[model samples]
Target chain A: MKLRRIEGDLWEIPREGRMRVPGRVYSVGPPAPDDPALQQVANVAHLPGILRFSLAMPDIHWGYGFPIGGVAAMDAEHGAVSPGGVGYDINCGVRVLTTALEAEDVRPRLHAVTAQLYRDIPTGVGAKSAIPRLSDDALDEVLAGGARWAVRRGFAAASDDAERCEEGGRLSGADPSAVSARARTRGADQLGTLGSGNHFLEVDRIAEVYDPVVAEAFGLVPGRVAIQIHTGSRGLGYQVCDEFVAEIAARRGEFGEDYATLPDPQLAAAPIASALGQRYLGAMQAAANFAWANRQVMTGLAVRALLHALAISERELGARVLYDVCHNVAKLEEHAVDGVVRRVLVHRKGATRCFGPGDPRVPAPYRAAGQPVLIPGDMGRYSYVLAGTARAMADTFGSSCHGAGRLMSRGEALRRGRGRSIARELAARGIEVIARGKKTLAEEMSEAYKDVAQVVAVMDGAGISRLVARLEPMGVIKG
Target chain B: MRLSLPQPYEDLGHTADVGVRTRGATAEEALARLVLAFAALAAGGAAVAAEREERVAVEGGPGLAGSAVALLRELLYRLATEALVPAACEVLRVDAAGTEAVVAFGRRDPVLHAEGADLKAVTWHAARLEREGAGWVAQAVFDI
Candidate 1:
C-alpha cells in the first residue's frame, strides 16, 4: 500500500481504486511498509459515505475488518454502519476510581486485597457472576437502564458515578426488544463478570503526576490508590455482533452489486437509513448499555472487596469514580465535515473518544478540564491518564489510542514464557497478581504488549491528547 | 462405526486471534472436523469427550461458503450461550436447494475440563470453504 507522510506523526493514504475517502494514520513515525494494519485502514476507506478519512491511532494493529485502533465517521444519513467496525466486545471500556488510602498503606496487604478481589469477583473462561441470575424482566431493565440500573439496584454508590461516564453511563435508543433471547440468556449470568483475555481489575498508585492541575481535577494525587476496571458486555455483545454479521452477510445481495466488490466479507454493511441498520443500531446500543451496567456492578464489588480486605470502613475507603470511557463503540456525534458540522456515526474500534474542553457533551464537573482519557497498560508497567484536546476534535474525530497494542500473538507469548515464572517476576517488582487461569498470566505478560509509554508519547506529541498523570499497578486480578 | 483417530485439522497462525484449517473427503466431513478443531481451541487440549448429543439446524446461505459460516455460527452460539462444545459432529442431512443442514453434535463434558481462552465469535475474515482437487478444505478464524 502507498502512503505519504502528511506531517510529523501523521500519514495519509491517497484515495485510490474504490476508496470513498483518504486514509489517515497517526503514529510517532510511519508504520512499517508491510504492516497488515495499513491494509485494513485502506479497506475501511472503501466504505460507502465515509467522511474525511478512515483514521488510525498510534497503537494500530491488524484486526478483522477495521484496524484495531481505527476511527471512522460515516454520514448517518447516507453512510453505512458495519458490525466489524464496532468490534465483538461492544463497549469494551475502562473505569477508574480514586480511593482515600495511600499506596504505602496498601503495600503491606497487597496480596490479601488481590486475593479478596479474586474471591469476590468472577474471572476466567465462562465464570459465573457474583450477582444472582437475572430474570427476563430484570435483564430487560439492565439492558434499558445501563449503569443507572446498577445505581437503582444499589450496585453503584451514587448517580454521580453514572454522570462521569461517557454518554452518562447509558446510551439512548437502547431497545431491549431488539436483543434476542439467546443474547439475553448468554448475558443473564455473566453480568459483573470479567471474561478472559486482557480483561482485568487492578489496584494502581498515582506514581507520577504529569500535569498537577489536570491530575488534581481528576482526583489524582501522588501516592493515592486507584482502582481500574477493564471489561465489556461479555457474551451478550458477542452474540449481538455475531447475529448481525451473519444477517448482513446473508443479505449482502440486497445492498446491490457494489457490496459484492468489497475486499472482505466481514466488512458487510447496510446504509444507516435501512431497516436492518436501524435494528442493528438498537441492538448495539442495548449491548453497550449492558457493558456500562457490568462495569458499574464490578465497581461496587471491587469497593466491597477492598473494604473487606483492608478491614476499613466506608468512610475510610472514600472510593469515588473518576471516569469511565468506552473504547469500542459507534456513537452518533456531530463533527465538522469539510467545515460544515453534521451528525455522523463515529466507529471506534480499540480507540477512545477524547472530546476536548468546552464541549458541552462533557460532564459538568469535567467541562473545565476536558474528558479524562483512561489508558491502561500491562500489569508490570505504568498506565496513563490523559486530558482530551482541541487538536483531536479538529483532526482525528476526537479519538485516541486505547491501550498498549499486542506486540506478540498469544501462541508466541506462551512459547516464549515456557519455563519462566511471570508471576514471580511481577512479584519482584512489588506487584501482586491473582489469576484463575494458568496460561492467562503468560499470555498477558507485559512483554506481550508494546511499550505503552511510546504509544502515549505519540498521541501527546500529535496533540490529540495531553498527559495528566501516570499510574503504576500495585495489585492486579485477571481472568 | 467408530470415530477415527488423528483428526484432519491444523492450527493456523493469526495476528490476534486463532485459526484452523481442516481437510476431509467431502464438504460435510471438512465442516465436521472444523467443529472439532473449534472445540480443541476452546478447551485448550484434546481431553474433551463425546458425553452428550444435541441436534442443530441452520439456514445456510447461497453457496458452500455461506453454509459453512451459518453452520459454524450455530455451533458458536451453542458454545457461548450453553457452554456446549462439540466433541464430534455428524452432518445428517444437507438440503442443497434450500442451503440448510441438520447435524448431530456430541457435546463436550463441561464439568471435568481445563478451559482455555473464551472464543467470543467466529469471523468471516479470511474464511474459506472450497473444493481442492479430489478432496475438500475449510478454514476459519475465531475471535478469542
Candidate 2:
C-alpha cells in the first residue's frame, strides 16, 4: 500500500515501523490492486538484517505466509530465513532436459512415452511412489548431498550434461538433524513422485529462437526435443511448513506486533533472532536438498522411460540435464549494499535467482554465461529460457519474474470449461495430454494463465534477463 | 443438479463436488434449495429425509459475486473436515456482507455415503455463480 513508482517496471514500498528496509516490486504495469504482493513486500521488511529491499516479481499472487512471486534478502549473520518465504514445496522448481533426438524421432512413440512416464513417475495427491525407500542414513546423505548423491549411486552420469545445473544439483548447509521425524515419515516413500497441484512433466520441442548465442549456450536448437520436469519435495516440505507455521504463531508475542502481525493468519512470522527461526532455516535447507535429489531420481526414471519407449540405449537418446534451478527457495548469498559486499539470506518464493554471468555463485562452466533461468508457460503457449545479467544484480540483487502468472483461478477455469471437451480441444491443437485426474486437467486448461512470452519480453526489454529460446509442448503428463 | 460422494485422498475420508442448476422465482430460494440438494447427496436421501432446523450465515463481498459457488466450497471444507452439514441458506444478504448467511443442516457425519470422489483442495480455476436465462446457475472444480 506504500507503493510509489520508481521507474518503468519498478515500484518501491518504503519500509515502515520495525521494517529494516523498503520493499521493491517488478511489474510491467501497475500491479493488480487486490494482489497481496505489496503486503508480502511489507512483511519481508520485518526480518532481521534485511538488505536493500523486499522484492516481488510481476507474476505475484496471494499465497500463504508470502506472496507467490515474493523475494527478500536477509543478512546471513544477523538476518532470519523463514521457511514461509520458500514455501511448502521446498526446492519445488523446474528442470529443462534437452535431448539430441528430434521431435520427429519421438512423434510415433508419443503415447507409449507418456504412458511410460506416467507409470514410471508416481503422481496425484497423497500418491505414494514405488521408488525404493532410503535408509535413515541414506536419506540424510541425500538431503545433504542432493544430485551428487544420485550421481554417486549411478543414477546420473557426470558428463557435459552434469555441470549445467545449479550447484550441479546440490546445496550447502543442509543439516538433516534439523528436520523432524514427522517430515521424514511423509517423505519416506515419495522420492520420485510428482505431487499434484501445478506439477507436470512435459515433452516439448525448441519451437523458436529469440537469441542465437544464448540458445546455443543452453544446448537448445529449433526442432530439438526436450523434457521439462516441474515438482518439489512433496510431503516432507509440507510437514516442514505446517510445523513451522504453528511454532512461529505460538511464539509470535516474542517478536513484537510489527514482526508478527497476521493480517492473514497464515502469514504469521517471527523475528530472525528467535530459536524457531534458526531451526526452520536448517530444516528448510535440508528439505531443499531432498527436493533436488527427488528431481534427479525422477530425471533418471524419465531417461529409463524414454530408452524403453524408443527402444534405444541411453547414448542414442542423448537425454541429458541441461539445467535444474530451484524457483522457490531461500539461500545465503553476498550482494552489495551501498556498494559494499554483504551476506544476506535471499528468499525467492515463486521466483528464480538470476545471477549474472561471472557471479561467483554460478556454476564454473556457466560462470561466463550467467545462471540459466527457465520460465514455463501453460500448456497452450510458449515457455521461455533466459540468462541472468549484471543489470539485474545492480538493480534487483539479481532477480526476475518466474512464469505466466495465473489470470483465472482453477475454479474459474473449470466453470468456463463445463460442457466443452478441454482434452479434445488440446488434442485438436496437436498436444497430446494424459493425467490421472479430470479435475486437474480441467483446472490447467490453457486459458487459465497469461501469455508467458509477453511476460518474458518485458523482463528482456527491462534488461533483468536475456531471452535464450522458446519451448513448445509436444506431450504433457499432469498430476 | 448432481450430488454424490467421491473417493477419499489424504485428509478427509470422502469428499463431494456438487454441480447445481435450477430455475425459479426467488434467487434465495434457489440457493437454499441448492444447499439442500448438496445436503441430501452428502447425507444420502435416507439419512437426510428426517429434517432438523439450523441457522447459519454465508459471507463475501465485491470479490464474491459468484460467492454462491465459493459458499459450497466453504461448506464442503467444513463438512468434510469439521463434520458440519448445511440445511438451508437464508440468502437474505447476497454479496453485500463480507460473508454470507444460511440456515444449514447441522449434524455430525450426516451418514456419509460409501462411494465418493477424493476431492482435494478447492481450486481457484473455473469457479462461477451466474445468472442464466430463467434463473441462477453455478459450477466449481474441486481438486481430486
Candidate 3:
C-alpha cells in the first residue's frame, strides 16, 4: 500500500481495490509500506458504505480486523457495523481523577497506598471482585444501567460521575434480553475486577501543565496527586463479542451484503438495518454498560483504599473525576460528511471521542474547555491530558488516538526482558510497581511502546486535540 | 490445567496480541493441540490441575477451520465463566458442521498460579487450518 503525504501529519491511501472511499491516516511518521496496520486501514475502506476515509490515528497498531487506534464512520442508512470494529473489550476505556493531595504527600507514602490498592482492588486471573457477586436480577440492572447503576448502589466516588462520563455512562438502547446466558454467566462475579494484560491502576502526580485554562477546568494543578484507572467489561464483553463475530461468520449473507467480500474474515459485518445488526448493537451496548459500572465500582474502591492508607478524611482527599472516555465502541453521532451533518455510526476501535468545546454533549462545566481526553502512557513514561478541538470535530469524526501504541510485540518484550528486573528499574526511577504476573512488568515496560510524547505530538501538530497536562506515575499496580 | 503433553506449536507474534502455530498428524490431532495451547497460554505458565472431566460438544460453521474456532471459543467460555481450565483435550469427532471432545478440567487456581493474560477473545484474524502432506497445521491469534 502506497501512502501520499496530504500535508502536515496527514496522509492518504487513495481509493483502490474495491474501496468505497480513500483511506486517511494522521501520523508524524507513517508505518512501513507493508505494515499490517496500514493494510487494515485500507481494508476498512473496502467495507460497504464507509464514508470519507477509513482513518488511522497516530498511535495505530495492528489488531484483529480494525487497526487499534483506527476510526471509521458509516452511513447510517446504508453502512455495515462490524463487531470487530467495537473490539472484544466493549467500552475498554480510561478515567482520570483529581485528588487534593500534593505530590509530596503521595511520594512519602507511595508504598503504603500502592499496597492498599493491590489488596482492596483485585487484579489478575480469577481475582474475584471486591464487590460481592451479584444475583441475576442485579446483573440485569447493571447491564441496563451502567455507571448510573453503580452510583445508585454507592459504588462511584462521585454521584455525578455519570454526568461527566461519555454517554453519561449509560447508553440508551441497551436490552438485557439480548445478552446470552453464557455471557451473563461469564460476567456474573466479574464486576469491579481488574483482569490481567495491560489493565492497571496507577497513582499519578501533575508533572506539568500545558493548557493552564483547560487544566484548571479539569481541576489539574501542578504537583497535585491524581489517579488513573484502566479496565473493561471483563468476561461478559468478551463472550458477547465472540458470539457475535462467530454469528456473523456463520451467516454471512443473511445480514444483507455478502461478508465474503471482506478483506479479512474478522471484518465480517452486518448492515445497520439488518436484524442481526440491531441485535448486536443491543448486546454490545449492554456489555458496554457493564464496563462502565465496573469502572465506577473500582473508583469507589480506589478512594476507599486511599482514604485508609493516607489516613485522610474524605473531605481532605477531595477525589473527583476529571473525565472518563471509552476507546472501543460504536456510537450514532452527527458529524459532517462532505459538509452535510447527519447521523452516522462511528466505529472507534482503540480510539477515543473528543467532542470539541461548546458541544452540548459535553458536560456543562467543562463545555468551554472541551471534553477531557485521558491518554495514559507506559508505566515509566509520561501520560497526557488533552482536550477536544473543533479541528478534530471537522476532520476526524471527533476521535483521537487512545495511547502510545505498542512499538514491540509481547513476545519480543519478553525476550528483551530476560534476566532483568523491570520493577527495580522503575524503582530506580522513583516509581513503585507491583503485579501478580512476574513478566507483566517486563512485557509492559516503557520499551514496549512508542514514546507517548511523539504519539500526542502528531495530534497536537495536526490540531486534532490540544495538550492540557502531563502526568507522571509515582506508583503503579497491574494484573 | 495440567496436560500430559507432546505438541508442536510455536509463538506467533503480533503488534498487540499473541498467537500460535500448531501441527498434528490429523485435523483432530491438530485441533486437540490447539485446545491445549489455549489452556497453557491462559494459565500463563502456571501448573494446571485435572480436577474434573467432561465431554464438550460444539456446533461450528461449515468447515474444519470453523470447527477449530468453535472449539477455541468453547474453551475460552469455560475458562471465563466456570474458571475451568483444560488439563487434556481428546478430539472425538471433527467435521464440517461441528466438533466434539472429552476434556479433563481443573478449577483455575488463582492462589496457586501466576495471574495470566486474561485473553479477551479468540480472533479469526489469520486463522488457518489445512492439510499439509499426511498431517494438518493450524494457526490462530488471541486479543490480550
Candidate 4:
C-alpha cells in the first residue's frame, strides 16, 4: 500500500498481488498515507488487460471502483470494459461559450441575468425541461445523432456546435435499441434540464490570461464574458450503468473463477469483443450522445436567456461555443503502447481527454494549439482554461484532471455550513448565486472543494496541460 | 403505525456519496426497511404519508446483493419518473429468481413535500445483504 515517489510529480504503487500493472498517480506531492484513492488505483490495476499502468490525476479522490480522476487504457483485443470506469453519469462534461459582451457590460445586470437563466433553465431534483417532451422517435434521434440532432432541430446556433464537441458530439456506434425503454422514459422530458448535486450553470468573466496567443485562439480574453454548463445524460445514463453492472455481475459464474476474485464486484467487466461488451458499448455511446445533445440544447437555452436578460439580439450577444469536453467516458483511440501504436479503449473516469497540439483528433481550429480543457471550480471562486500538451500524450494517455475534486463529504459540508448564509458569503465576495433551495447552496459551498488553481498548477507543473486563462464566477445557478 | 422500539436504519459516512445500513428480523424485513430508508433519504426527512401503492418485480441470479440493487433501482426509477416516494414496502415473494414487492408511496407534491438529495443511482459498491445471528442486515451506497 506504500506509494513510492518514482519521479517529480509522479508516484507509483509497485505491481503486487494479481496486479497486471503498476499504479501511477500524478501529484504535486505524495498522497496522504491513508488516502483510499491509492487503494482504488491498485484495485484498478487488478483489472484484466490494463496496459502500462493504472493512472490517477492530481485531483484523485476515492470513488466506488476506479478512483475519480483515474485513467486507464486497455487493449481492445484482450481487455475488458467496466461500467464503473465510466461512472453512473456517462459523458458528464463541461462546455464553455464565449460572448461578445465584456464583464463590465454585464456586471451591473448580474442579478437579472442570473435570474433569467434560472427561469429559463430548470434545476433541482427531477426538474422538467422548459422544452416540450420528446416523442419516442424524436428521443431515439437524439440518442443516435447527439449534438447534431440539436443543430438540426435549431437548438444549436450552427453545425460548428457539433464539430466543437468530442466525437463530433455523436458516437458512431450508438445503438438506440441497446438502450432500455425505462432509460428512455426517464430521459424523455429531462433534456435541457440540469439535475441536482454538483451540476451547475455559471456565467463568468475571463479574469486573467496566461497564454495570450492560445487564449486569443480560444476566443478567451481578459474581461470577456463566458458561460459554462456542467451536466450529463441525466436519469438515462444512470439507468444504463446500473442495468449493466447488475447484468454483468449476475453473470459472473459464466466469466470463470477469475472473475469471482475481482477486488470489487462493482468492477464488473466483459471482454471488449464479448456480446455483453458490444451491447454495453452501444448503450454507453447512446447515453454519451444524449448528454452531448442535452448540453447543446442547454447552450441554446442559455443564449436565449442571456439575450433576453440584457434585452439584446443574438447578433448583439454574439454567443458562440468555445469547446465541449467529456470527462466520464470510454473510447477506442490509437495510442502508442510500448512503442507500437495500437487501438485501445481509454477509460477516463472524472478525467478529461487532452489531445496535444497537432493531433488530428483536436478540433481543426485549435489543432495547432491543442484542445481547450475547461476545469470548473466550486462556486464563489475561479475556474481555469488549459491547453493540452505533448507530455500528456506521451505520459498520461492524453488525459488530465477534470475539476477541483471534492475535499469534504456533503454531510460534513452541510454540518460546517450550518446556520451560515452561503449566499451572503458569496454575495459579499461580489458573486451572485441562485439555487432552488438553501440546502444545495450549503452542500456546494466553496469550502467543500479543493482550490482548482492548485489542481491545475499540478497538471501544469507535470507538463500535461498548460494554463491559458482564469475565469472568475460572477453569477451562478445550481441544480 | 405505531412503531417498534429500535430504529431500523442509520446513515453511514461516505467520502462523496450517501450510505445507509438497515437491520430487520429477517431478510425480507431487512429489504423492506432498506426500501423505506432509501425513501426517507430521497424525501429529505419529510414525513411521508402512504397514499398509493406501486408494484415492482426484479430478478437476480443468486446472491441477495444483486436482487437488492435491482429492487433499489426500480424504486429510484419510479421516483424519478412518477415522483412517488415510498413510505412502506411489503415483500410479496422471494425466490431464487428474484423478489416481488408492493411499495406504498406518497403522492408528488413539491409544495407540501420538499425534495432532498437527488440520488443519481444506487451503486453495487461494497453492497451487503446478509444474515447476522437471528436477524438480517443490509447496506447500500447511493450516488447523489
Candidate 5:
C-alpha cells in the first residue's frame, strides 16, 4: 500500500476495497522504510463499521497485535472490537506526581528516593505487590472503582487523587465476570507493582515551562521536583491477552476463509457483535480498570516512601497526582463522522488520549484548559507534558505519541553496554539508577530510542497536542 | 540430547542459563555445532542426521543485550520452521555488538521436552553475558 503524502505531517492510504474507511498516517516525513505500521492502518480500515480514516500516530512502530500507535474507531452499532487492538498490556499507561520540593531540596536524597522506590514498589517480571491479594468479590470492586478502590483501601487518598485521572480512574462498564479465572489468578497479587520492561519510576525536575498558565494549572513550577510512574496491569493483562488470542485462534476459521489473508495473524479477531467480542471487551475493560487502580496504589506507595525518606508529612511533601492517562487501551468514544455523532470503539496501542478543549469527556476543572498529554522521553533525555488541541478532535481523533520510541532492540543495548557500568555512568551525570537486572538497564539505555524531541515535534507540528512543560530526569528506578 | 541443570534467573521466564561452547576439526565446523545446541530446544525428535546451510543476520547494538535477542529469536524461528530444535550453538563470529553462529543437532532424536507454542519474544530482563577467561557466560529472558 503506497502512502500518499497529504499535508505537512499527514499521509493517506486510500480505501481500496472492503475497507470501511481510508487510512491516515501522521508523521514528520515519509515513514521509515520497510515500516509495517502503514499496513496496520490499512488492516484497521478493513474492520467492520470503522469510521473516518484508520489513524496512526507519529510514533508508530511494528507491533505483534496492533501496530504500536494504531487507532481505529468502530461504530458502536455497526462495528466490531478486537482484543489485538487493545494489546496484551491492557491500559498500560503513565502517571506524573507533583511535589512541593524543589530540585535542590531533593538533590541529597536522590539516592535514597531511588532505593526507597525500588524497595517499596514491586518490579521485574512477575514481581508481586506489597498490597494484599484480592478475593473474587474484592476484585469485582476493583473493576468498578479503579483508583477509587485504592483510595478507599487507604492505598491512595481520594482528596489528592480523584480529580487527576481520566474517568476519575474508574471506567464504567467494567464487569468482573468478563475476566477469566486465569487472569484473576495471575493478577491476584500484582497490584501496586511496577512490572518490568519499559516500566519505570523516574524522579524529574520541571526543566522548562512553555505555557505558564497551563503549568500553573497543573501545579508545575519551574525547577520543582516530580515523579513519573510508568506501568500497567502486568501479569493479569498478559493473561487476558493469552486467553483471548488462543480463543480467537481456535475460532479464526469460523470468521471465514478470507480471514487467513489478514496481514498479520496477531490481528486475528471476531466480529464486534460476536459473543467472543463481548467477552474480550468486558475482560479488557476490567483489566484496564485494574491497571488504573494499580497505578494509583503504586503512587500512594511512592508517597509513603518519600515521606519516610524525607521525614515529612503528606501535606509537607505536597505530593499529588498531576495526571494519569493510559496509552494502550480500547475505548468507547463518540466522534463526529461526516457531521453525525457516532459511538465508536477506538483502540489506541502506544497512543495517549489528547481530548481537545471543551470536550465533555475531559474533567470539568480542565474543560477550558484541555486534557493533559504526558509524553515520557528517555531517562538520559527529557520528557514532555502537552495539552490537547481542537485540531486533534477534527483530525486525528484526539491522540498523541506515547514516548521516545525504541530505536534498538534489547540485545543491541546489552551488546553496546559491554564494559560500561551503567549505574556509575548515570550517577556521574547527576542521576541515580537502580534495577533488578543489568541487561534491562542496558537494553533500555537512553541511546536505544529516537530523540523524544523529534517524536513530540511531529505531534506538535501535526497539531495533535501542544507542549506545556519539559522535565529532566534526576533519578530512576527500573524493573 | 542430555539435559543440564542451569541457574535460575530472577527475571527470565522458565529459562535455564547454561554455559555452552563447541569445537570441531576447524572453526567453521565448531561454529556449526553451536547452532545445533540452540535448535535442539525447539526441534522435536526426528530421525536421520543431516545438515543444512542457514544464514543469520543481526543489526543494531552488537553486544549481548542487542545481538543475543535476535540470535535467540532466529534460532527459535528455525525450530518453529523445521520442527526440530538444535542441540547446541557455536559462535562463529562474535564482533563486539554482533555475532555469527551455527548450530548442531543430535544424531538419534528422541521425544523433545518442549511444547507446541510460539515463543513471542526475548526481553531485556536479566539479559547479560560476560567474557570470563577463555569462554563466555550469558543469560536472557524470553516471552514464552
Candidate 6:
C-alpha cells in the first residue's frame, strides 16, 4: 500500500486500480503495510459513485468489511448501499446525560449504585427483559417510533430526550414490515436490557472542561456526575444485517451489474435504486429505531436504580439527556461535493456525526455550539465530549472518531491479562468495575486500546472536531 | 470426574475479530469438528447433554467453505432462537457442494449451563477448507 502525507494528521492512498475515489485517513501514525484495515479502506474507494474520499477517522481499526471509525458518502442516485457498511450492529451509539449531583456526593455510595443498577437492568447473554414482553402491535410501534416509543411508555429519563437525539430518535422511512419475524422475536424481549460485548453503563464525572462556553451551552458542568449508555439495536439489528448481507452477497449478480468485482465479498452492495437496496434501507432503519428506544429504556432503568440507591427524588437528581448519537448508521444528508452541495447517503461505521454550528439539524438548545459528539473510552481512563466543527463537515462528511481504537486483539489482551485481576486493577484506579465475566473485562482492559486522548487529539489537531469536555469514569457495568 | 477430549480447533485470533481453525483426517470430519468447536464456544465451554438428535442439512456452493458457513449459520440461528446446543456433530456426508450431518442437541438450561458469547453472524471473511499436510483443515470467522 502506498501512502502520501497530506499535511497535519492526514494521509491519503492515491486512487488507483478500480477505485472511484481516493482514500483518506486521519492519524498521527500511518497504517502498517499489511494492515487489513488499509485494504478495507482501499476497497471502499472501489464502490461506485464514491465522493471526494473514502475517509477514515483517527481511531480506525479492523472491522469486518468497513474499517471501524471509517466514513464514506455515495451519490444517492448513482451509488451503492451496502448493509456491510453500516455494520451488523445498526445504530450502535452513545447517549450522554448530565446530572446535578457532583462526584463527591456519589463517590462513597458508588458501589451500591452500581449493584442496584446491575440488578435493575438486565445484563449478560440471554438476559431477560426489564419491561413486560411487548405485544406484536407494541413491537411494531417500537420498530417505527424509537425513543418516542420509550417516552410514550415512560421509559425515558427526560421528556425531551427523543428531541435531543439524532434524527429525533426515530429515523424516517422505517418500515416495520421490512423487519423479519425472527428479528422481532429476538428484539421484543431485549428492550431495557443491556447486551454483551463492549456494551456498558458508566458513571462518570466531568474532570476537565476545554471549551467552557460550549460545555455550558450543553449543560456539561465540571465535576458533575454524569451517565453514559453504550449499546445498540442488539439481536434485532444483528439479524437484519446478517440476513441482508448474506442475501445480497449470495445474490450479488442480481443486485448490481459489477457485483462480482466487489473487492471483498463482505463488501457486497446493492444499487441504491434497486428493490433489494430499498428493502434493506427500510429494515435497517427499523433496527436503528429499536436501538434508540433500547438505549432510552435502559436510561430510565439506570436512573431509577440511581435514585433508589441514593434515596433521592427524581427532581433532586436533576438528570437531563444532553445528546444521543448513533455511530453505526447510514443517513441521507446534504453536503458539498465538487464545489456543489448534493445529497449523499453517508455510511458511518464506528464513527459519529459531528455536524457543525448553524446546521438546523442540530438541536436548538446547543445549535450555537454545534452537535455534541460522545466518545466512550475504556473503563479505566477518561471519555471525551467534542463539539462538531465546520472543518469536520468540510473534511469528513461531518464525521469523527468514536473511541480509542483497539490496539490489541481480544486474544492478546487475555493472554497478557492472565492471572491478573482486572477488576482489582481498575479498583486501584478508583473505578468500580462490575462485569459478569472476568474474561470480558480482561479483553476490554485499557491496555487493549490506544490512548483515547491521542486519538481525539488527531481530530482536534486536524481542526475537524474540537474537544468540549472530558469525563473520567468513576464506575462501570459491562454486560 | 471426566477426561475431556482435546479440542479439534484452536483459537484463530485477528486484530478485532475471533475465529477457529480445525484439522481432521477427512473433509467431513473437519467440518463436523468445526461445528462442535463453535457450538461449544456458544455454550461457553459447558458440557451439553445429548438429549435429542436431528439431521441437519445445508445447501452448498462450490466447496467446503460455503457449506460450512451455511451449516454454521443454521446452527447459530437454532442456538440463538431455540437454545439448542449441539452436543455432538457427526458429518454423515460432505462434498464440494453440500453437506448432511446428524447432530445430538441439548436443550440449554439457562440456569444450569453457562451463558455464552453472542454468535451474531458467521461471516465470509477468509473462510476456507483445504488440504494441508495430508489432512483436511477448515476455518471460519464469526461476527461477534
In the range A263-332, model 2's lDDT, one tens digit per residue, is 4434555555567777787788888888888888888888888888889888788877878889888887
Single out the weakest 10-residue window by summed lDDT for candidate 6 chain A. Answer: A251-260
Chain A vs. native, model 4, TM-score:
0.99
- Better structure of 1 and 6 per DockQ: 1
Tens digit per residue, CA lDDT, model 4, A391-465: 998899999999998888788888999999999999999899998878889889999888889899999988999
Docking level for model 3: medium
Query: What is the clash count for each candidate, in the order shown?
Result: 0, 38, 2, 0, 37, 0
Q: What TM-score, computed on C-alpha atoms, does each candidate reach?
A: 0.96, 0.78, 0.97, 0.97, 0.78, 0.96
What would the per-residue lDDT of candidate 4 be over residues B12-77, giving only the tens digit for each residue? 767678889898777777878888788877877777788876688988544787778778888888
- Candidate achieving higher DockQ, 2 or 3: 3
Regarding DockQ, does 1 or 3 come out ahead? 3
Expressed as tens digits, the lDDT of each residue in B1-144 for candidate 6 is 111223567887766667888888888778878888787777777777778888898776535777787788888888877888888878887766678888888876665554456677787766777788999898888876
Error of 2 at B53 (Å): 25
Assess each model's interface with DockQ, reporting 2 decimals per model: 0.63, 0.05, 0.74, 0.65, 0.04, 0.55
Tell me the spans in candidate 5 whose CA falls farther than 4 Å from its real position. A17-20, A157-160, A256-260, B1-144
**Pick by lDDT: which candidate is best?**
3
- Which has the better DockQ: candidate 2, or candidate 4? 4
TM-score of candidate 6 on Cα atoms, chains taken together:
0.96
Return the lDDT, model 1, position A130.
Answer: 74
lDDT of each: 0.86, 0.69, 0.88, 0.87, 0.72, 0.86
**Clash number for candidate 6:** 0
Model 1: native contacts recovered, as a fraction = 0.59
After superposition, which runs of candidate 2 have C-alpha atoms over 4 Å from their true positions? A14-20, A157-162, A262-264, A271-274, B1-144
Off by over 4 Å in 6: B1-6, B60-63, B94-98, B108-115
- Against the correct fold, how does model 3 do in TM-score? 0.97
Order of models, best lDDT first: 3, 4, 6, 1, 5, 2
- Candidate with the greatest DockQ versus the true structure: 3
Give the CAPRI class of candidate 6. medium
